[model samples]
Target chain A: MLSKPNVEVSNKSMLGRLFRKNNKNIIGIFTVVLALLFISPYIYIVLTSIKPSSDAISSSPTFFPRQLSLENYVTMFNQMPIIRYFLNSFTTASISTILAVFLGALAAYGLSRFSSKTGHAFLLLTLCVRMIPMISIAIPMYIIINVMGLIDTRIALIITYTAINVPFSIWLMIGFFNNIPKEFDEAARIDGCNVFSAFIKVILPVSLPGLATAAIFCFMLAWNDFLFALLLTSTNAKTATVGISEFLTAYNLDLGPMTAAAVSFSLPIMVFSILVQRYIVSGMTLGAVKE
Target chain B: MTKESRVSIYFFAPAGIFMLIFLFFPVALLIRDSFFEIDMIGQGRGAFVGLSHYVDAIRSERFIGATTNTIIYVVVAVGFELILGLFFALLLNTAFKGHGIVRTIMLAPLMIAPLVSGLIWRFMLNNQFGIVNKLLYDFNITSSRHAIQWLSDERFSLFSTIIADIWLTTPFMMLVLLAGLQGISPTLYESSQIDGANKIQTFLYVTLPSLFPVMIVAVLIRTVDAARTFDIVWVLTQGGPSNSSEVLSTYMYKTLTRYGQVGESSAMAVMFILLLLAISSYFLFVMFKANKK
Candidate 1:
């Protein structure tokens, strides 16, 4: 009986030791492998963008180019209205994001502070609108924009993106607003400030991070939008996303300019994402934890 | 009304009106249009067709194929995304250096416009002189002579789309799951470890249960989004190679805009909306119930 117990204890210890050793190796190796997989495609795109046209089209693509050049980037700027598209995208997305964030903040504050049952209903309704597929709204929006003579206008894009983003932005902002203690509002109210003034002066400053989160997401959504941009805009107000698609149609099978345009079109969004990485992640996972 | 009530109304009115006009009104108009046949060429001079359009839409083989393809695409793409996303999330959740940079880089694909992603993938997946084919050939995994038709072939086009979709969206899943993972208290893992629980046991008992709620939310969101994927697939294949890769959204676009079959297209649109509503509501119901629990 003594020998049997001793043997069992030794066996368990051996297994535990082996498991720990293997687990460390496995986790470390897996993390590195995953990191590589995730980064490779992006690296490939950047490398290819800088590669000469001849090398890009070569049968065996070079992982590391012998001669790197900004020829493609230069060609992209010269061959297409790249600057014009960037301006259009920037203006539309920025204006829409500003409007959406403002509207969303106001609505969220209202809902959180007053009218409990009705506010819940209204919030639910907003979420429902957000759930509706963009394609479902595509045709009617097309007709409505045409009828209103707003097609191909930046105003049209701004209004449309705002309408779509408000629901989500409000939803996210409500969570943030709810987290702000009621005492802060009461203190502001007691300080001879009305609700609106309190909101502007006190609440807004405190919730800047949340607001930034909402604004960044709203901007990215509007910036990266393709479908509405395609439908609403023509040459005059065409956003970068739509402009890139137009490039595909214009260039057809010409890989050089197409790839260059693709690289140029994706650059701003990449930079924007990296810039707002913290806000975006926080905004995205805002409601994942109730506390 | 109370002072608070009045203030609430004033604050909410603008956004409410905006949503009503642009979102609710358009949706109402879409529902109405589906009931009528409006000819684009003839300046909206078409008769009310009632349920005829819906009937035609349901009967059309193209619509049926689109429905199947969409279901398949959503199931496959979302399945892979969830599994792969969970795996990556678990990997990233560990205490590792440079994890933040990796997370941001993983999100790089998600940041790009879907159209741009499609274009990039199109270049990479091109049968002739494409990077993917060249890589395979160089590694002797496949011959240059046997270069796979990534986009043109029906069997492969959908898979290629899935690859692009996974690349763009798995990060979203990872982000959500990472949030979920963070919510799991380290105490639970510590207790499990003290009790002599193995890694898989700890994951099964502790990690999964804690992650379930977030997983449901993540999966539902991804499913709804995937079902409505239009821009990526539209740019990549345009429902090409005999309409083998066409989903409902692309099919509707082609039917209405390309072919000018407004009635049929509207019918398809209505059906698509109904299907989307059903799926979303189902997900919402599940989420609501889970939250209640």
Candidate 2:
């Protein structure tokens, strides 16, 4: 009886030891599988983009293409003014990002230095404005832009995106500015720098990371926007998002160029986003989670 | 005013005026237009129609159906995200090899544009040439490649969009929850273990309660975002197959742009804003009460 009880105890301990030893390996496998699952769809898109037109739409499509060619990409460029769409997306996103960050950073500095009822109330108002659905103001914005005769122009896209991005920029920069000591600007002030000049010199230099984060977010917003682009721009100012979507209807179920266009349109943003993933994760929740 | 106060006003003026002209002014126009019959082509405002547009929206089956679909989308999409997000967060909380790479890979979806995501999904969900059904058939889960029609069928169109959204946003949820999990104190878990709590018990009592505040914030942000979703649904099905997948944003777009019913769309937009405000205010109230404790 004594030996039997001792044997059972040893068996249990052996099983526990084995579990503890293999647990890490099991977890490693799981993490790899999950990562592959996350990325496989993207890889598939890339592969499909490279496949010849006939292979892409084949009834029995395989994961690995039988033939690899850039024919679809060539077709995509020929079919539409693809380069123009890219340029429109790029210029609008870049210009709006710069403008929004500049205006927003200034407001953030003002609010941080002098916290009054009006400033605080303005902060709240911006927050509420951020919550307003984009569709709510679409018609009015369309009419107003039409009245200004800026329709079908990249300038219209730039103006609208800048306005849409400013509130978010202000909100994000305010958090960063609040962390900055009042003494930085005060020291600059003692050296005969005025409020605006002090901000230009002392504050803006230290807030580069904050500005970069806000810019990246604004750029993403403008780049990813489909609704406003669809409404505001017609031909000359059509963005990549709208242009790629047009392939859905314009080509009548043409998978080859469609996939190729989708890949080219999305790849740069994906690479850019991944490289700056750290800044993005923090900006996503608006600094709700402190690092 | 003091000199510093005066300086601050100069700082505020540029952004303030810009927002007034572009943001606030447009919203004010939206409200005003909702009350009048507006002509886009002729650039004319017809006679005031009181609350008739609002009444028309309330009575319209399309508007009501869109509202129902929006609510359904928000609930199911966010619901699955929370569960899957927590699962991934817990799985990654432990130290392992390639942890950083795996986490980065998980974030790739968040980086992809929603319009692109929608397009990719539409391609994959195609019955004849799609890899998704192909894989399922290879694995013997389905009898044929055309066993399920993803975008073409009315029953699965909305669900198809939901899947794409789930794929795109789940990483965000995971990142937020992972951060929350990291913030939790180790001592709480140690104490729970010492008190004879199993893994399940410890997760339920120590982990969940501690993660509640972060969860609420993440959920609220996602709720508002998912409610405004336009790109994915628009790209995937355009709310088609007899309008089975029509959500508020798409419906309003069609009403205004497709049908050119400016007054009706504006009224619907106003109603949509009010509903979102109510939902967010309730969430804020709850968060406020939670914080007071």
Candidate 3:
């Protein structure tokens, strides 16, 4: 026997109270605050990049730039072969990613489809390599690469990175390929497709998300690499990481150009992560825990 | 049977050979090199000074410092990253608006290369013109009017390295834990709630038990990574302020590449690898046991 006006008012108040009590609201605020903290250094870098060196070095730092300047960016380009370094990083990372992914997928397909002790062994080897620290390989790799006369070359970087990433790519792809119902592959085979053809036609299309994740990981590994890039490549084939290292010299450090260089170097990985975040997270953590 | 076997071998041969050559072969060479007394300048000119390099490395004060620092680095960094990562994961797991974007942004540091992260932090931790100091001063948090010498001081350099490491790696831990959290069924929480359980009790009984396996794996990975940390420390401190920040890898690199003592470095590298292997194997065993249970 409630009046319509009274019923409507009560409903409105209940909804309002629900909103006030919702835990999501509290969580949302907390997450935003933490996210801002996570990105604070990068934000500071961007702000510092535009400010004059004197302002940057001042005891009391300004939060915002009073005057914006492109001097750091300009100086970074002029002082070093920034473009050449970028090209080196790009070409090496791209080629390595392509090679690693293709070969990894091929190997993963074979491993997942075939049931054999050897396949298991291959999988074990992949995991072993993934776990071993890179220093274990650095000196011998140096010796071997030197012997091959491939010092200070993009090919050397590409080959090393590709070799290093293939194991991970294969391991990741195996899980993805495994998750797909084997019935699809079986049905394709029954329809007169060979294993290779079925993998190409059916499996590849279905595992695009997995492939993308692996490709991004491979690219990031090659791109962000420093130790191999530092030891193997001199100025002739130095990547962005090596280029950033050159910002610090024996006599003096250029803070402005260094910040600008660091920002530019990190931009690609940042964009890629933002673009393909969903796959990267799921793919990286796919086989980490068993159901 | 023969034909199928042959095809399988053909499929695996490329990957297998690559690992044996590039991965196993290098480790073998490291072992071989560790036994020799090779100077840094020469390519391979050395005598077979069996165990001499190992003896020297064990006795070296720098090696001892590196070992101590490496242990401290791994324990502190991994411990803190795990705790912080778990906290953030729990925060993000709540049904929140814009949670997805926040999660992605939190993962930004993980995606960036360690060297680049080191450089980024180096800029931020700079005594002059660094924003950390700026913020501290702006908020009147620290009365020390000068920019903190983060890398220059040995006492604070390890902590500085830890900060950068924790920043770079906590996302990895969070991602793993988040995935683990997702695997958990909501029905359990609902049942607990029906029993008049509070948030903390439900989380302790349900969430913590389910997350144990993934947490172990995540911690293991982070521990191994933290123990072998080189690039960030290398870029930031380079084991400076009188070798106070030197971890094992940096110590090895300095001996071989910088100080021209290849044999000693190789021995140090071998020891470092063995230590890591032992730790990782133990973790793997724990994981297997957990899975069996």
Candidate 4:
């Protein structure tokens, strides 16, 4: 009799589960809805980019574009020296990333492996340096650059951005370096590898993900910068970000080209972000938890 | 020192030299310059003004206004982000289908440049043609088609900037919190359930305490970012509708570059650095503690 009751209970639980939706499904629905809401602005921007100038700012904005055209993109290219700005941004970001990661990785290795009193002190100091707002140092930077006669040149931005990005890059790279087993270092030495060669051939290969993360961050810092570019560069070395900001403020209120410019500016980063979402999560939360 | 230990010094030299010459020296120079008044037209420091510029900065009404506005912005923005971020993180902490896609989409806004995000929000919140107002009207949330004056009104401008900041940064909080959430063992939840504890009790006793360290780290990150916010506020409202939204960075920028008051601006920069240092030390402290734990 007892066995029969237990079997009936199991069947009843199965029936209940079949009839009722689970908690996970409800959470999934909410997640989808929330994601849509968060992404709604980009959706609007994409739609606006394709719309005709006249239709973009109409009295009642269309949820979906009725007519699509590439006139804005054409105008963005035709009027602005967009390629020049693009080249400036690319040069600065790429150079900064390469140099910052190279130097930062060196510092990170010492800080991670050696762990000397001075190294930890320097590490703490780097953290403090990263916290100070860019604006706090902008005036001095401007004065320094002007004195050096490096203003209005990509070299000026490249140097300044490299300095700004290195500290945090070192911090990030150190976390990843710490993750790597010390046995590799000892093993490399046993194989007659010097510290530099071992770092090059052994430890660094594993730290590629960390390098990529630091590189992406440095690139974004350079790419997205406006204030330094605004204060430091006049016209010759203006980055794409500075170009877009100025394009907006000019007397001509061309909303369509502006959206087109914004869209183009965001597209590369978005593509890169989606491709490496996992690394970004790890990169951002590094040193936060024990894991 | 041993050869190995001495060789490590070479590795630190390149980064250390760059930071000392470029980053730290400028800041030190800025502090030293605060005592000297600058002749803006001559592009040179003119006279040693002692603490007069510091006194002037303290007495300036604009400085006071910017400080007050910044504090409010940081507190309110961080408050809203944490609440909304925690809520969304919990909602998505499931092994449901489409989770990866949804999570990826949530981080898309973060990849955009801060300045561009400001521009996008600026366009979206336009008084006449904004879709936000249209949606509100369509849903009967607003009584008229006249778009809300997000950027113009002094009362609403600061809040609007906060909303934009929240939109951009909430994903950061969510991602960090979600990582924390996923790290918790499922066995904890099962054991709690078996103990006859209710959902609220489980969350309070098990989930929250476990997540506390991560929460501190997340809040500190947001705090540091929000306290230094410049780009979005500048683009969104230029700290205006009458300086209602002026943060320290924008105010410092205007004082130094536009007004040519270098000495006073340096003093402002000094005070600003102190504030940042105080806040960041706490962040570092907590992070160190968390690591040790």
Candidate 5:
């Protein structure tokens, strides 16, 4: 009688297992549907950008592109200084990233190795700097840029971006540097490699991933910034982001060209982001999470 | 200086100088300008205004409205992002086929510029030619295609920006939370199961506690970030339909740039900074306390 009851319980558990397997599949399908919904905007942009201008704005717009054309891209390039803006963005972002990473690496090394109370305080100061609203400093930055005759100059943007990025880079690199065993530094010292050469030859190569993460973040910030670019630049140094916003102001809003410009502006970074996608999560949460 | 001090100076000085000049100096100027009446046209820091500009800002209806909107935007947007992000993170945490690809695709929005996202959202949320309302109407969720004036109507304008933000940054929250979930030890789940805890009980007792620090940090970062949002709102509605969507950043932008009231704008910016600082410090304090546990 006890054995019979145990067998029945086993049978019931098997049914439960089957039910859960089906339930799991259902949840999987539901999640996939949700993911599609999340990315539909991107799909919409691509489809709309490829469509002819007439189809793009038709009263009865098709979900899919009725016809494909590069006419929008052609118009975007012809009508605007988009290429200049792209080049400007590239110049400022890259230079600032380089400057920020280099300077930040040095400071991070100092902070990591020294272990001084002052270093701790300085690290906290960076946190404070990060918290300060950009608007508060932006007005004065505008006035200073104007006074220095650096307004609408790529150099102005590069310097400003470098300053903004350095603190973040410092915090990120300090984490990486801290992770490196102190014995590595000691080994380098035993080989008669001084601090500078040891840092250059040993520390940096090992920190490549961390450096890349910092550089990527710094570059993204500088590249995607609209406020600084909008306020500081007019014609010569206007970024692609600022350039596209002007498209909206034109008498007849051209969805085709606008979407095309957006695609072009966003494509490079999207690709870059995916290529280095693994580093992003770590970069984002490094300061937050302990190992 | 001592040898250790010298080493510290050598390593840290360049970045320190950079910050002192470009960051600190501008901030100092900002604080100073907040106190003085400045004439943009005359190129003069005209008079010692003391706190009149601050007084004006405190009393100004537009300033007050923008501040309230900013708070609402930060709270609602971040609140929705946290919940949706947690939901998605949990969904993806389960073992499923092609989950990796789905996760990667979900992060696509994170790569796109906020400004571009705004533009894309604007296009998607457009009344007549837009897809959002059309889909709603087709699904019988709304009465007509133009029923929700996302940009033009004052009622939905702020929410429209919030929606775009949720779509844009929810991936970030998901990503961070997923990382947190992965960092959690499987042994905890095993122990909970051995203790006869159900799925919901396991999540509440084990998962939530383990994920607390990550969630706090993520929320703190997102809170500060959402507080200072500028580009999205600017691009989408320009705080339009009678300033319905005017956050502090856009309002400050208008005050300084369009209105040319440098002193008042400076005062407002200073106040905004103080508010952000207060919010961040509280978050930091909470995170610190959580870490102690």
Candidate 6:
């Protein structure tokens, strides 16, 4: 934009052209500054995580760390059950994604293919579930999990995560399935396949991109959850999110290891998201495609 | 039952059962628990106290403060995010080269756990050694010997949390609005130009109306999420500086987890749900109304 053709020297239009050129330059500069504002904290955290101990806590702040080292990360690994937390988070997140996607696909198929007024109402009511804050349901959930003797278990977290994410998954699937021709379902029926087999052998295969998108989203939502993990789990099932939170309350000493822990906690999911962000656009924009 | 209805029933069974068991049953229990004084340990029932817990929470200073703080936080944060998101969406819609990299960087915060960003914000808001303070001093916004209490002082703690939240969620608003922006046809702009419309008029008459649904969707999502804000408040101040920054989520959490007030916390939860439900219903109505139009 800044490389646009230069203004020709003409008396009548010189000022207007100059003003337009300057406005473009202003927008270009503003865009870069805004990007830096958004990106700087992550960079700062990463740098602080790896900075040598001497410079990490130095009274004078430095933009870039002088001596890069892995000391803080080493300490975080040794001192905390970071690996266990990661394992728990990963296991629960994956299980929840699979469960949510499967169950949501089923419900969405029922709603989309059946197309009853009752099904429409059910879908609308489920949309309301997205508005129900997790914290509101948490008090009873805590007691309910305890009542069932499922407290401090990854399955508890997985069940809760799946339950919460299912509504979203269902909505996304409805959007995806709506686009698929109903004639395909008819074609399968004409071939003598039942509804279940028709979905499995026909619709399911073609909706891979949509499934991948929804699955990735469910995984992300479950992985990033902290409130559920906090309220639901005890020591055995604590997630990486709660593990990092404890470093604040329990290990409140040096910021180095905490930052290191924070970085490492977020690194895998961050990289995962960056790789799959293209899918996020399709997965989440169902709001734009809705009735 | 007919074959199709049976198939529908079979397909819906897993999710329907799961929600009824986990989500709805728990909600029923929450409503019941609010009327009883329950044991902290076993959660055994005590005495039936009808509407007393609700009354007390309604009258409580802490709850009132938390409600006030939540309103301020949600209003300021979501309002700012909308304006800034629309601004950036407009910028992104320029189709400039390398904007893809910028878009990825802008959205990096959304991918990571919001809890981590809350922690990072806490680190950045440290008065003594934080970059925020350092930058302030660099620009002579403060003295080397003095720093603003970004999270420590009562005046700035909630504001600090809002800034962190803005950092975390604005990308989401931007992406949603950008999707909305991109959905508008270029022919609309050409028609507006053909009619001698300027930038301001084109934006007011053409862009805003077209983006309304997306804007409504973005607002609905952000507002509900903002109302339930926990991670940032917990990490930053724990609703601290003497409860000045306490949001409903942190208040409800601390009430149950710290004070062990199950009955009252359940009441608080009830109130929180109703409030959100009422507000969200209004938004949902608007959404469906817009869709009809």
Q: After TM-score superposition, what is the CA distance of residue B115 in candidate 5 from its true location, in Å? A: 0.3
Q: Write the per-residue lDDT of candidate 3 for residues B22-127, one digit (tens) a residue.
A: 6678788888988987764557668999999888888989889989999999999999988998999998988588888898788877788899778877777777
Task: Give candidate 3 misplaced runs (Cα > 4 Å).
Answer: A1-22, A116-123, A180-198, A250-253
Ordered list by lDDT, greatest first: 5, 2, 6, 4, 3, 1
Report the Cα interface RMSD of each model, rounded to 1 decimal.
1.9, 1.2, 1.8, 1.4, 1.3, 1.6
Chain B TM-scores per candidate, in order, are 0.94, 0.97, 0.94, 0.93, 0.97, 0.96
Candidate 1 TM-score to native: 0.92
Clashes of each: 0, 0, 0, 0, 0, 0
Predicted model 6 interface RMSD? 1.6
For A1-291, candidate 1 gives per-residue lDDT tens digits of: 355668788999999988976776677577877767776776677788788877766766777776887777777777778789889999999999999999989998988887457556756766566567787788788878888999899998998889889998888778778889989999999999998999999999999998998888898888888888887888899888776775555234456666777877777778878887888778767555444
Global lDDT of each model? Answer: 0.81, 0.87, 0.82, 0.85, 0.88, 0.85
The candidate 5 chain B region of ten consecutive residues with least summed lDDT is B1-10
The collision pairs in model 3 are: none
Residue-wise C-alpha lDDT for candidate 5, range B1-293, written one tens digit per residue = 67866786789889989999999999888999999989988888798989999999999899999999999999999999999999999999986777888888888778778899899888888876788888888889999878898888999999999988999999999998998999899899999999999989999999999999999989998998898899999999999989999999999999999989888999998888888888888988998897888
Encode model 5's per-residue lDDT on A4-106: one tens digit a residue.
Answer: 6578889999999989888888888999999998888888998898898877766566789978998888889888988999999999999999999999999
Residue pairs with clashing backbones, model 1: none
lDDT (Cα, tens digit) per residue for candidate 1, span B151-245? 88889998898788888888889889988998889899999999999989999999998888888878878888898899889888888779988
Over A1-291, each residue of candidate 6 has an lDDT whose tens digit, in order, gives 355354553533878778877777677677878898778999899999998755666667787988889988888888888999999999999999999999999888887777757556766766678777778878888888888899999999998999888877887787788789899999998999988899999999989888999899899888889998999897999998989887775324567788998988787767878888889866656665333
Better of 5 and 6 by DockQ: 5
Quote each prediction's TM-score: 0.92, 0.95, 0.92, 0.95, 0.95, 0.93
TM-score of chain A in every predicted structure: 0.87, 0.90, 0.87, 0.91, 0.92, 0.87
CA displacement after TM-score superposition, residue A255 of candidate 4 (Å): 1.6
lDDT score of residue B230 within candidate 6: 92
Give candidate 6 misplaced runs (Cα > 4 Å): A1-26, A116-119, A189-192, A249-252, A288-291, B287-293
Q: List candidate 4 stretches off by more than 4 Å.
A: A1-6, A19-21, A116-119, A189-192, A250-252, B282-293
